[model samples]
Target: MAITSANQLELLQTAEAVAREKMIEPELVIEAMEDSLARAAKSRYGAEMDIRVAIDRKNGNATFTRVRTVVDEELLENYQAEFTADQAKPYFEPQKNAQNIWLRDGAPVEDFAAGPQIGDVFQEQVPPVELGRIAAQSAKQVILQRVREAERDRQYEEFKDRAGSIINGIVKREEYGNIIVDIGRGEAILRRNEKIGRESYRPNDRIRAYVKDVRRETRGPQIFLSRTDPQFMAELFKMEVPEIYDGVIEIKAVARDPGSRAKIGVISYDNSIDPVGACVGMRGSRVQAVVGELQGEKIDIIPWSEDQATFLVNALQPAEVSKVVVDEDAPRIEVVVPEEQLSLAIGRRGQNVRLASQLTGLDIDILTEEEESRRRQAEFNARTQLFMDSLDLDEFFAQLLVAEGFTNLEEVAYIEQDELLSIDGVDEATAEELQARARDVIEAANREALENARGLGAEDSLIEFEGLTPQMVEALAKDGVKTLEDFATCADWELAGGWTTVDGQRVKDEGLLEPHGISLEEAQDMVMTARVMLGWVDPDELAAAAAADAAEDGDAAADAAPAEDGARTEEAGA
Candidate 1:
């Protein structure tokens, strides 16, 4: 192969053909050709010479050149390609009137007298190389390598933004239980675990899957598709329901026991359109479309509610809920159902409750009405026993305290006198006696806990920390945090129990002071206060940071307000 006059245009034609086949820019292919030609020229000329090739985009003419750069004496390492400033003077002699030559090279304009400034370049046209058999093969390999890289880059850029969408493709083949799908412009992998149940595919079979992820790997752009994702079901609804696609109704949440059962919570922006009815469609047509795609997976379309209890009740469909007890601090809920509805609420193998948990983003505990009553009775008896032993009261008096919602000695000891007096048969003197007994018991327990903490080598500094109770101090000491310094060094999550994700499940990490009713926010405040007291943190700096954070939050809220108001105004105008 040679860069002859008759064949010059052939180079550009080949580049365009390759670029079109690879779906990349033609300029990229031309640049790769230039690199391969330059390498071959270097092999033919002196190997040390700096050779470069450029192809004219308009006429497809090839220009070969040798370049040498003027550099500082100490930095000039390649003798053939770089020259020291002194050796480059001849190249600059003809351009003596070039304005501010010294200044352009970082010297003062007033000192504009120039020999050859460092970084000045010299170039001369060179004869094009005649490629022999081995040289042609080497150039071909270089061009192929560059073209493959450009193709990969183009593919990555094309698919990166397409993730989280649904795509249709033809099944190419199966490799190691993974289905290879030809997605027109690129190939995608549908991993075995991402398939719904025992779904199988053969070559040339058409498949629709969620674009779960798009990653740029060393080999190529990897597109991962999934059929078992909950978002897959949500997207299917969006496709089938016109209201969803038009944003009249929004899918609030979706939970799927892929191939078995799924639940989708939806809400409508327009009150006229019922989200559930719109999703279910006339005669269940729209829902049936989604269900058919999901391999007959049963779907429960429920109307989403801001009230969690109401939403949970709706999520557990065809079952009667007697009551819902929500513990906001624990972020868990208890649902009490009728005895007959217990099995339905739980579903087969607890699938109903599990999907409901996923949909609500909360852990759920289901119990029968009879079981709830038993648990309540047991709690009442425990509180009654506590009052009887701690206050030296009769069982009837204890029962009265429990009935009045007095659960602990702390409330009995610290509550307003009027509250205790409001109880039937309780006079001022009786109320005073009851409070005195409660306070005595509380004080004794605190003193015992403090003594134990001191025995465990707890420092006076730790014992005197304002936020920690005696029981909290004792718990910290038991956990080897016996000093104020140790307390300050602890993480907020270590001082207050938090949930951690382990093996794809959220597990609870119990904290030392958790049993003492310490919240994460309270723990953070106490630890920061301790650091400030120990002169480890500046209170002024902390206040400044907090102020900046609040300002940012205010700005974000302000930005959101107008958009919401505009939506409301539009609705009103309509």
Candidate 2:
């Protein structure tokens, strides 16, 4: 326990081992030891005394000395604030009333002797104070502290450049629900806000994150890592997809509903490569790895197209598409699909189309097959009438739509009253009238449908098909569909089949087309005229029927297509 000098060598070896482990030089430790001794000397000696300490670097040993100032004749006057020459007389009795008294050689030998007065001198013969065990222990602590400071500086230098760069880390601890990651050099703070919603980490778990920021605080530099930032996803792609990293493919835009689905728009500058395929990799292994990192979140990597309709179609994935009509000025798209596919195109809760619209930066409206068909028919009818009117009288009615680049009534229906007024020669009143006319057409169609439903439940007297009469036909001729071709083209019989009361009950066809509007005689004449014009009823039959019609003047042939016979074989043979 007390092997003295031999034990000191062992302690020196232990100190040297710690210094090497902490990357601190032994010379700094020795300097720290000397500094501690000087501080100790200052506390032991009075403030008027001077002290200094020096260490031998080779031996790890410390030495100290005490110093006194060599006083001159100037100290006799104003240096002492508390004790003036007169006031200090009791302390120095012989100089009671003498202001200019200089100490005579060997006048008095006392503790208050000033400097080397009366020929005093320093003796360089004094040996160094032998440091006791307690001073040695204090020196060890100071040395260790200096070593820690040096190591901290080294650590800071190593990691400073790594700031703002992603790194793999292990979960070291979780304090107050905040996870601390050990990223080799130092700990990084992963705040709750920086965490992805679908991910969770436990102690010792390995995770990757973006180094968002690094701050030099008092204790040390703080590394801030984020997993939720959109840049993190971009960076992840850059790391995983070789094409993007190589700059062959570029990511245009990224929109995400994080932890559920994300949409990324990408394009390739090179014609040989496909951007989407590159991101997806062979059999989707590339994106699958990324999705696994994001905890099974779905990623839709769509090809970025210059055409907005094409891009929007890709954005709304898994939806069967029929057609897309986009108006760039209005920034809207009308999506058309089969009637049964409407629900799919719109998606569950409309999320598919909604996200697509967001990704493509366009407003989308979905339409069913029937609605699209009606629209096409209305457009055709409008175009044909305009052409016929302009051709017959040189009124340029067709040019009205053509000049505006509109070929259809559907386009007119979409034009607002204000927009219509902006067109040349369209006054506000005229625009309003045109809008009213368009609306009336829609309303009349709806009312006809309603009246047809009503007649299905009640007697046909309240819901007569007035155009069945000759007088009514003349009136309806002004509304177009004047000829048999026009009437057949619109599938009038389909409308006839649905005629019913509003309550949806069937009504008796009691010659109702007559009393409520046109009479029976006129209805029969109109049917005969339609049959003759359509070439369905022969001229001889029409003549005979007219003779018979004049006697009885009742109903005529019902409108129906002939049954399909062996026409399929005949057409195939032809």
Most lDDT-accurate candidate: 1
Candidate 2: segments with Cα more than 4 A from true spot: 1-16, 23-149, 198-202, 304-574
Candidate 2 similarity to native, TM-score: 0.43
Which digits, one per residue and each the tens of the lDDT, describe model 1 over residues 416-453?
99999999999999999999999999999999999999
TM-score of each: 0.89, 0.43
Global lDDT of each model? 0.86, 0.59
What is the total number of backbone clashes in candidate 2?
15
Residue 384 accuracy (lDDT) in model 1 = 97
Give the per-residue Cα lDDT of candidate 2 at 383. 71
Q: What is candidate 2's local distance difference test score?
A: 0.59
lDDT of 2 at 122: 20
